[model samples]
Target: MQPFELVTVKDVPEAIRAQAASETAQQGATVRFIAGGTNLVDYMKLNVETPRQLVDINGLPLNLIEPLPNGGLRIGALARNSEVANNKLVQERYPVLSQALLAGASTQLRNMATTAGNLLQKTRCMYYRDIAYGCNKRQPGTGCSAIDGQNRMLAILGTSEKCIASNPSDQNVALVALEAEIHITGPKGERTVPISRFYLLPGNAPERETLLDPGDLVTAITLPPVPTGAKSLYLKLRDRASYEFALASAAIVVKRQGTRIDHVRIALGGVGAVPWRSLEAEAALHGKEATAANFRAAAEAALRKAHPQTQNGFKIELAKRCLTHALTQAVA
Candidate 1:
């Protein structure tokens, strides 16, 4: 990694001031925030990220994991993945999130990775990592090499002609399924963003990943209360059992009333430019019978608009089976 000025901040406002000087939150941001440094360091080592200044927010008071007054959960931005996953409240109430955390990197990574770092995790696309290749995400307007190159592990759902890199975070997939809200503090003031509006599709600007501005510091994420009979789980399908990213993974929360499905929230990872929340799949399952056929139909509805690349056409069916089986187990 190249030489960079590191500034440690004790509060959110200080961190915001340090980062707000950046022009954009795009790939070439000269100033950036660093918490866990697990993902950012990897890119820095590859020279994929060349930030001139690093705002370290580790000393900030943002590591709390507690219950909200409304019976929901508030996960601080700096909360360790292992701490959140093993917490009694998270294990019992948000098992899908817990499972996804455990399904992420490895035990060592889980212990070090923070909530905000996972929130802003970058893709594992090979083309984007290697500077020799042309990647719109890495260097905008140069062209995406993965469009016709090695892209078996890239995205299929949120593909534009410019980019097809998959979102590679298990924690985010579970967050999208739970309809969590992101709390942020920036130069202007504070704001709350719904999970649906958090990430941007790689339509024209693959360089800009999330809605985060240059100075925006993620404070915490709030998850609303789960429904009464809601059953949640995470299922990850990968080439290996550990130390590998998901090929297709599902985070499902299902609630059944008698024989009819009342509540359903579906989010898939390793399949889209973002942690994909399948409203179409949820629509198919709402008030429907919890039968194998219904689950199959819902899975089909989820992948109806998939735009598979040359080598990744199998991901469409693989994602479908992954979601269907996850839904089945969630309801059962």
Candidate 2:
């Protein structure tokens, strides 16, 4: 929306150098890199972001998906959402991820969206999305209107009084269930964050969202090999079926040994600040005889700590129902 300078970097090193120089210019001075530009451009238009310089990383070798040695997949940051979702290997090995992707925005948007961008896409909260509203995330120290406002789509976990914005990516929800690792490269060096730790809780700093540094770029996402990922299910409950954000959703991967559940991974979306992995729920079902009672108990354990707002209080029960149904379907 505002005037900006565009610089195209030839490689990762050059991009790093450019980022450091820009940071030295001023604190939080507008500087960002563009990949697909679908999310970034839209945010810029909304004035939520006003970067002075744009670095293009379109020429980098961060666009390929590689198979891991341990029978898992590592997805490059630049791999288009459509490409990754439609890949035979991904579809076969991580059907829950593929299903989540298919349930996201749209085919056209997926074609233009990158895996990294999807992870970094800003919250879809009406207050944060609109500049006119008082959103602490957009304008720190202002206020969060969604706290007491219409909050049917807000969060129930990792939320403070200042902010309740929910992470909007369906892929991240499935990644949490799969126990994925995020590979990041920055000025200091390279570091890996379990996708679980990539997103931060709103604790007292509602403005800060992720653990990424100012110039850090996501390299790849590595998913651990889970025997049940192929048979997993991602169930989304919303006002409408297609193209709508989830009011509550469940990603369930269950591995059964005979009639007993050997391993279970559960993650929730549209109900938390981050992709919420329910260890309590997993513990409830792990090594237990898979049954309707076990699934219901697991769902109850998962939602026990949920703190929902006035309008969204139903999310606790909805998430429970959804998780129960997902667990049943995944085992079937």
Candidate 3:
């Protein structure tokens, strides 16, 4: 919305240099990288994000979806969501990831949204977007209006007094469950960070969302090999059937040996500040009989630490039911 300088670069090194040069020239000015401008453009129109310089990285060679030597997958950051969801390899190996992607926004938006951009999408909290209200994420130390305002869509777990906004990414929940790793390149070089540690809780500093450093660009996401014959499911519960954000969603991957559970991973969305991984539930279900009673117990263990707010109390029960249903579906 504001007048800003735009630079399009062909390669990763050139893009990094362009961003660094912009920062050096403008002193304290902000610089943002644009791939698929679906989310950034909306924030820019509202003046929520006011980056003085934009570096377009669409020309970079980061749009491939390739298979690793160890049977895993490497998804480029620029790969569109629709492409990843419809890719035969993704649909065959990681159906949960594909299901999560399809359960997200409409087909039109999915065709334009990139993998890295989707991971970096901001919270949809009304207070954070509206400039008239005070928000710790939008403006640190100013106070969070969502604390006492309309917080039905806010988080119930991993929430702090400063902020209760939820991480609204369906793909991220699946990634957290699958233990995906993020590949990032910056001025110093390149590094890989596990998906579990990528997102941060809204502790005192809600403004700091991810572990990405200044001038760092995400290159790809790597998913480790899924166990053969593993059963995984992603169940989303929203106010409607389609084109709606989840009120409570569950991503469960279960490996069963006859009647016993060999391994299990559970990740929850729409109920936490970050993609909520349930290690407690996994521990309870491990080496146990995959039964309805055991599933209920696992669901209870997962929601044990949930602290619900005034209007979002129903999320506790909703999340439990959703987890139980997802587990049943995974086993079935």
- Per-structure clash totals for the candidates: 0, 1, 0
Best by TM-score: 1
Q: Write the per-residue lDDT of candidate 3 for residues 149-258, one digit (tens) a residue.
A: 99999999999999999999999999989999999998889999999899989899898889876678899999998888898899999999988898999999899999
Clashing pairs in 3: none
Clashing pairs in 1: none
lDDT by residue for model 2 over 1-332, one digit each (tens)?
A: 88889999988888877766555322343688788998899988988888888989888899898889999899999999999989998888888999899889888989989999998888999899888899888777889999889888999877898899898889999999999999988889999999878888887777777887777878889988887423688999888878888888999888888899888889999999888999999999989998999999999999898889888999889999999999989888
List where candidate 2 sits over 4 angstroms from the true fold.
22-29, 228-230
* The 10-residue segment with the lowest total lDDT in model 3: 20-29
Candidate 3 runs further than 4 Å off:
21-29
Tens digit of per-residue lDDT, candidate 1, span 1-332: 88999989888888988998987655467988998899999999999988899998999999999998888999999999999999999988899999999998989999989999999999999999999999999888999999889999999998899999999999999999999999999987999999999999999999888888878889999999899879999999999999899999999999999999999999999999999999999999999999999999999999999999999999999999999999888877
Between candidates 1 and 2, the lDDT winner: 1
Could you tell me how far off, in angstroms, the CA of residue 153 lies in candidate 1 after the best superposition? 0.4
**Which ten contiguous residues of candidate 2 have the minimum total lDDT?**
20-29
> Which ten-residue region of model 1 has the weakest summed lDDT?
20-29
State each model's CA lDDT, in order. Answer: 0.93, 0.87, 0.91
lDDT of 2 at 94: 89
Q: What is the lDDT of residue 40 in candidate 1?
A: 94
TM-scores of the candidates are 0.99, 0.96, 0.97
- Residue 5, model 1, lDDT: 95
